[model samples]
Target: MENIQHRNINVNGINMHVAEIGEGPVVLFVHGFPELWYTWRHQMLFIASKGYRAIAPDLRGFGDTEAPPSPTSYTAFHIVGDLVCLLDSLGLDKVYLVGHDWGAIISWYLCLFRPDRIKALVNLSVVYNPRNPSVKPVDYMRHVYGDDFYICRFQEIGWEEEFAKVDTKKLLASFYFKRIPNPPLLSKDFAKMFNPPPYTIPSWYTQEDLDYCASKYRSTGFKGPFNYYRCFDLNWELCAAWTGSKIMVPVKFVVGDIDATYNFPTIKEYINRGGFKESVPYLEEVVVMEGVGHFINQEKPIEINNHIYDFITKF
Candidate 1:
């Protein structure tokens, strides 16, 4: 960790924080929900040691980056725009792109909106979900998964307040250690999920790590992060021009076999069959590690790092 260098740079009309190390061909790492650039700590160090410049930035609403108050500011275009300006600020034109969960979603948009800026991509967890065109994302999620589904429940106006009420460290622990292999259901009585006694930290996560994330949330609150979900529909509406677009960039995807996202109803079929390939025309590889859960990179750091290095080296 001491080898990593941290800095804040101006990008897309806000101050952005980034962690970087080593020096060679650049590899940009983007993190997911409930995570900051710190989540990629292991991979950054490992990849940097392997002679590649590894850069991880806290997306607009996460970590030390300035979080715009309006949910409308968290759109795909806004997030991708921040990254484009970030690369330009750093004097980089194209780099290897890697992202996980929401980061993966945004990477898909980045490749779609600016493939010229990406040499190759290694995306984890979430697959590229093609727009339906007929229904907005939130409405589609509600119709398919019902109101209790976590994403649907997150759409409510004051949900972040409810999240704030819980103890920050404990709330983060619950999210990090969760192992349910099905779609998450968060009822109106969602507080109960955090109320279970005797919570244990997973082997992959430390108390210090939880505290680090908690301290950031304590200062910023969860509103900025939650706004990412809130902008789903608006993102859908704003991306109409990209309706039938294919990701075109060279790509590799990885997911944990037991990860809740991989188990989503038809996700397996979508990934294994022609659908994923149809959209990601340049996909190069797919790996499903057994016994792993949602936080694949942190849960299985060495293997994840190797996967990333192997793919990026080819380019």
Candidate 2:
């Protein structure tokens, strides 16, 4: 990790922090919520060793990147714009893309809005959710998961304060290690959810890792990250033109069987019953890793690296 290089560059009207290593074909790694570019440390080094330049940025509102104040600024357009401009600033015309969680979500939009810029993609944890022309995203989520669903709860202000009241390290540990396959619910007493007794740090994650994440969140607060959830409806609205659009880039997707996202109602049916392929017309492979959770890359680094290397090397 010490050999990896970090720097900041101006992109999309904000100074963005980026981590890079090696010098060859570019593989851009986008991380999900509550995660930083550091999340890609293992894969970065592995891919770099294999002759691919690995680039991971702390997306807007996370890590060392500039956090714009408005919730509207966190939409897919804004996030994708940041990336597109980042690539432009770096003098790359096209690159292999890899993302997990919200990063996966943004990678979908990148392919949708600017397929010309992507050579291929490997998205983790989340799949392509086609836009519903008639309903907003948050509305559909509320209808399916109700008000206590984490995304819905994040829409309201003050979650940052609530999260702050709890021990930051423990809170992050609970979020990173919990193995619940069901979608998370954030009730009125959401803070209590992090109070579970005696959490054993998973072998894949260390106390130092937990401390590093907590330190960043404690300094930046959670509002910027929560703002990503706040833009669900807005993204739905702004993306109306691309409704039912199929992602045309060659793609590979991987997920953990135990991940809550994989267990979302009807998601398995969608992925396995041709719905996922229909939306991602060029999807080449799907890998489901047993016993892994949402953090597939971190939990199964070598396997995930092999999956990425195998696919990206094809083009």
Candidate 3:
């Protein structure tokens, strides 16, 4: 495995810190919320050794990337633009794209907006939810279940400030703790993992990982990333215009079966039952890892790397 070389490139009026390794057909990794380029370390090394140039960049609001002042700038449009600029900066006309969590969402939007630029796409842990042309996340929550959902509350003002004030180490530990294995039917321990307030800690995450994540947050704070939630309406408005657009490129999706994000009844039962063909016309495969969780890459790096290598080799 080759060591990753860190580089910065001026792209889209921002200086982006990019980590690249190996040299062949390009593979770009986009990290999700609460993660950075470091999340792809195992994959980067493995893919590089396999004769593919593996690259990861700190997304706009996370890690070493600049944290702009305006919350409005964190929208998907900006994120997509940053990525497009990154590809241009690297002189890649097309490349394989792999993303997890929020990164998955951005990759979905990218495939919709610019299919020509993506050779293939592999998504982990996040599914594409087509935009409701008439309503946003807040409106969807209101109409279905009132405003009791913690995610809805996260959209409110001062929410970031409150979350930012907490101990960063605890926050990272709690975030990682929720993904551990549970009984056949999510047990009390698993249920407690998703509790809102304190975000109860799990024992699996190492102190070193927690400390590293906390240090990054200490420097960047959470405002820029938190602002992503605040731009639901604008993102929806932009997405509405692309409703009928399909991801025409080759695509694959992988997720952890026990991931809390898909704990909703319909999600588990009907996820593979595809009725929305127009949204993802080229989806090639879907993989569900049994005991993993939201941090799919970290929790199951070998499986993730194998899937990525298998997919990218076809290109």
Candidate 4:
């Protein structure tokens, strides 16, 4: 851990925080909601050991990075721009990219908008959703999944007050383990949902891990993370220019069979049938770890490290 270096670099008009290690072909990691670069610690160390430079950034609006006060600033363009700038600042021409959750979504956009900057991509948990020109993203989710869908709950932007009512560990617990309902209604008081008299965190996540994350969130707050959700509609609007675009970079996708994103009925057919390949023509493989969940990289770090090493090493 001590060998991993942490620093802030100016990118896309914000000071972005990055954690990096090793000295070989670069592997950039992007994280998702309610998470920081810390989420990639195990993968970073493992990938670094495998002769790759592993870099994970606390994407703008998360961790030590500067959070713009507006949701609009959290759009795909803004985040992607920050990343491209970060790469440029590091003198990296191209990198093997890996992302989870929101990071996966943003990486898809990065590939679409700037394929010239990526050598290959390994996206986990979330699959690419090619823009649907007819309807906005939030509207589409609302129609298909309903207004109470988790994304819809974040639309108006007051989740933080209710989020504050619970302990940071519990908030992390609810997010990391609690299963969302079939229609994905994120209860207003959802933070308390993880409670049971004798609570337990997965054995893989240690108390030190929880304490570290708790301390970071205590300083940064979750609004920065929530803002990513708030920009769904705006991203749809801004991304119209690339409505029919496809991700051309070499790709490998891994998901937990039980992950909510993979369980979406449309998604299963899309991934296995043809929609995913149609959207990402260069996608090379898809791996579903039998019993794993959304946080696959963290839950099964050794396996994920092997996955990243095996795939990226081929290029």
Clashing pairs counted in every model:
0, 0, 0, 0
Name the candidate, 2 or 3, with the larger TM-score value. Answer: 2
Q: What is the lDDT of residue 27 in candidate 3?
A: 90
- Runs in model 2 lying further than 4 Å from the true structure: none
Off by over 4 Å in 3: 142-148, 180-205, 276-278
- Candidate 3 per-residue C-alpha lDDT over 165-277 given as tens digits, one digit per residue, 9 for 90 to 100: 55777666666766543321212233234344655434434556667778988788777777776787778886777775667888888988788666643565556578434
| Residue pairs in clash, model 4 | none
| Candidate 1, poorest ten consecutive residues by summed lDDT | 189-198
lDDT of each: 0.92, 0.92, 0.77, 0.87
Ranked by TM-score, top first: 2, 1, 4, 3
Once all C-alphas are superposed, what RMSD does model 3 give against the true structure? Answer: 4.5
**Which residue pairs collide in model 2, if any?**
none
TM-score for candidate 1, please give it. 0.98
* Candidate 3 steric clashes: 0
Please write out the lDDT profile of model 1 over residues 1-315, one tens digit for every residue: 998999999998999999999999999999998899999999999998999999999999898999999989999999999999999999999999999999999999999999999999999999999888999988878888999998888888789888887898878877788887978888796765668556788788888888899999888888888889999999999999999999999999999998989998899999889899999999989899999999999999999999999998888
Give the TM-score of each candidate. Answer: 0.98, 0.98, 0.88, 0.96
lDDT of 4 by residue, 103-155 (tens): 99999999999999999999999999998988888888888877768888888
Q: What are the per-residue Cα lDDT tens digits for candidate 2 across 134-178? A: 888888889999999999899998887888888878777777887
Q: Against the true structure, candidate 3 has what lDDT?
A: 0.77
TM-score of 4: 0.96
Between candidates 1 and 3, the lDDT winner: 1
lDDT of 4 at 137: 82
